[model samples]
Target: MTTPPQPPERYTQLKAVGLLIGGISSFQIGATLAKGLFPLFGPSGMVGLRVCLAALILLTIWRPLPGQLNKKTLMLLLPYGLSIAVMNFCFYIALVRLPLGIVVALEFTGPLTLALTGSRRVLDLCWASFVILGLYLLLRPESAAHGNLHSLDPVGIAAALLSGCGWIVYILTGTRIGRTLPAGLATTLGMSTAGIILLPCLIPTLPLIATHPWQGGAALSVAVLSSAVPYILDMMAMRRLKPRDLGILLSMEPMLGAISGLLFLGENLSSARWVGVLCIVTASAGNVLTSPRNTHH
Candidate 1:
C-alpha cells in the first residue's frame, strides 16, 4: 500500500543523509591526519601517494580493462583526475601553513559559488552573503587565535584559493564521470591516471618511502580514509542527488574541518572564528533545505 512507497523513499533519504555525513567526516578526519605526514613527505609527495595508493586499492577490486582506452573516456578522465590531484595537493600544502578550518572555509567558496550561481531565489542570495561574511571573518588576520594575524601566510592562502578552483573543476567533471562510468571502474582508472601525472613530482618522496616503508603504509591509510571510502560514498550519493544539491551539502566541510582540526591538530579558534563557522553552516544548511525536494536515483 502507501507504506510500500513511503518506506523506499524514506530509505533513500536516509541513505543520502548517511552518505553525506560519512563522506564529510571521513574526508575531514583524514585531512587532519595528513598534517602528520608534512614533515616526512611534502604536499606533492603526499598527493602522489594518495592517488597511487588509492589507485592500487581500487584496481584490486574493479580491475578495469587496460585495453578500453576510448577517446570519450580519455576526455572525461584527464580533467577529472588532474582536478582531484590539484585540489588535494594544494589543500595539503595550504594545510601545512594554515589552520585546517580556515583553509577549508576559504576553499569552500568555489563549490558554494557554483551552487549559488544561477539561483534566482532571493534567500539564496542572502545565504551567499552569509558565506561572504563568514569568509571575511575567517580570512581576517585578527580572527586567528594567535594574537598576530600576519602569521597567516600568503603562500598558504594562494594555494588554498587554487585548491578551490581545482574543486570547481572536480565537481564539474566528476558529476559527468560519475554518471557515465561504473563507480569502482571510473575511480580506479581516474586515480591511476592522476598518479601517473604526479609521478614526476614524487621522485623526492620516493626515497623517503623506500627508506621507511611505514611512510608508504601511512600514505595508504590516508588514501583509504580520504579517497577510497568517501569516493565510493560520493558515487552512491550522487546517484540520488543533483550536482547542485550535492555541492551545497559540502558546505558542512569547513565546519567539520574546524572540529577535526580542534580535536586532532589542536587548531583552536576564537569567538569571531566561531561566528564565521556558524555563518557558513547556517548558509549551507539553509540552501540545502530550500533546494528542490524531488530527486532521481
Candidate 2:
C-alpha cells in the first residue's frame, strides 16, 4: 500500500511545471536574441561578453563567499564549470555558422540520447527512432551537384555535436552537485568559474569595444538574456522538479528555438524539418506523460 500524498508535495509538483515552462520559454528567447547578435560580435566574443556580464550580475546578487572546500568537491565542480563554459562557447560558435533552429535541433540529440539510453522498454525505441528521423531531416544536405553544401556547415555541425555532449555532461554533473549545493549557489559559482575561464578571450576583444560599440551592447544583451535571466529561472525550476522530469520538460527547447527563429530571424524550415520537429516533440511529450510522478529536486 502507498502512503497518501501531502499537500506540499502537490504544490511542489505544480510549481515545478510552472517553472519548467517559464525557464524553457526564457531560454528560447535568449537564444533568439543571441542569434540576432551573432553578426556583430561573432560567436566567441559574444559568448565571452555574455559570461562575463552574467558572472558580474550573479556576483552582485549572490555575493557568494569563497571558502575552503574538500578536494573532492573542488574536483567535481571544476569540470562542472568547465563544461558550462565549453557548452555555451561551442553553442555560440555553432550558432554563428548555422541556422538557430537547426543548431538547436542538432543539440537536442544529447539529452534525447541520454533519456533513451536509460530505458529498457520497447516504447523507448520508438522515441529513439523519432529522434534519429529528426536528425536525418535536420542534417540533410542542402546543395547537390556543385558541392556547396550550404544547409549545415561541417565545422558548425561538429561544434553542435560537441555542445550536445557538453550538455549531457552538464546534466549529469548538475545532478551530482545538486546533492551537496543549493541550486542557486551552485549555479552562481559555476557561472563565476566559467566567467573566469573566459577572461583571456575577453581581453583581446576589449579593444573591439571602441570600434564596435553596438557589438558590445549586443553582447551585453546576450549576457542578460541568455545567461543571467535563464540561469535564475533554471535554478528555480530545478529546485522544484526531478532531473528526469526536467529533462523531459527541457526537450521543448528545440521547438521553442524553431518558433523563435521563425518569428525573430525570419528563418524557415522545410516540410521535412517540421515533421522532424513534430516527431521529437511527440516523443518527448510521451516520455513525460508515461514517467513516474515523483519530483526531481
Candidate 3:
C-alpha cells in the first residue's frame, strides 16, 4: 500500500508537469521557427545551426569537466551523438517538404514502436492497430484534401521514418548513459559529440550568417527553445514525474505540433490528417496508460 502524496509533494508534481508541457511547447515552437528559416538557410544549414548552438549552450551551462569523460563515456556518447545527428538531420530534411504536424506524427512512430515492442498482450495489439490505421490515413493519397496524392513528398516521408529510427537509437543509448553519468553531463557530452559530427554542415552556414547577422540571433533562439531549455526542463520534470505520467504528457506532442503549425506557421491540415494525428496520440497515451509497470524490454 502507498500513502497519498502530501500537499507540498503535489505542488512539486504539478510544477514538474508544467515544466514538461513547457518543454514540449518550446520544442514545437522552435521547429515552426526553423521551418520559417528554411528559405534562408536550407535544411542542412538549419540542422547544423540548431544542434551545434544547442550543444554549445548546453555545454556552457553544464560544463562537464574533462575528468568526467572516459573511454566508457566516449563509447556511450558516440552512438548517442550519432543518433542525435542523424535524427536532427533527417528530421529537418523532412520538415523542409512536409507539414510540421505530419512530420511530428510520422517521426513519433520510432518511440511508439519502441514502447509497444515485445508486448504480447492482446490489448497492446489495439494500440498497434491504431498506429497502423493512423499511418495509412496520414500517408494515403486519397486522404489528401487537395485531391493530389503527390502533395505529400515520398522522400520527405522516408526521411521522417529514418529520423524515427535514429530516435530509437537515441532513446536506448541515452537510457544506458543515464545510469553511468549525471543527466546534464551525459546530455552535454552527447550533444557535443553530435556538434562535432555536424560541424561540416555548420561551416557552410557561416557565410550566410555573416551576411545577415540577425540570422545568428534566430538560430540561437531555435537552439535554446528546441534543445537547451527543453533538455533542462525535461531533466527537472523527470525527477518528479512517474514514467507513466511523463509518457502520457509526452503523447500530447503531436497534437501540440499540429496546433503550433496551424497557429505559428499557418499550415492547415486536412480532416484525414487531423484524425490520423488524434489516432496516434490516442494510441501513444493508451500504450503508456495500459502497459505493465516495472517491465523493460
Leading candidate by TM-score: 3
Across 1-297, the per-residue lDDT of candidate 3 in tens digits comes to 977769889899999999999999999999998998899999999999999999989878889877887888788889999999999999999999899999999999999999999999998899999999999888987534456554589999999999999999999999999898988888888898999999998999999999989977898899999998888899899999988889899999999988999999999888888999999999999999888772332
Q: What lDDT does candidate 3 reach at residue 211?
A: 96
Task: List the candidate 2 regions with Cα displacement exceeding 4 Å.
Answer: 1-19, 142-150, 239-248, 292-297
Worst ten in a row by lDDT for model 3: 142-151
Index of the highest-lDDT prediction:
3
Displacement of the residue 266 alpha carbon in candidate 3, Å: 1.1
Kindly list the per-residue Cα lDDT of model 2 for residues 1-297, writing each as its tens digit: 977788879889788788777767777777778777667666787788888888888888877655634566677788788988988898888988877877887777776677677787877788878888888887887664456544768899899888989888988997888677777777777888888898876776789888989777767777777777777777787777776677667777788888888888888777787777777777776666665532434
The whole-model lDDT of each prediction reads 0.81, 0.78, 0.92
- Prediction 1 global C-alpha lDDT: 0.81
Query: What order do you get sorting by TM-score, best first?
Result: 3, 1, 2
TM-score of 3: 0.95
Off by over 4 Å in 1: 1-16, 66-68, 143-151, 237-249, 293-297
Question: For model 2, what is the alpha-carbon lDDT of residue 262?
Answer: 88
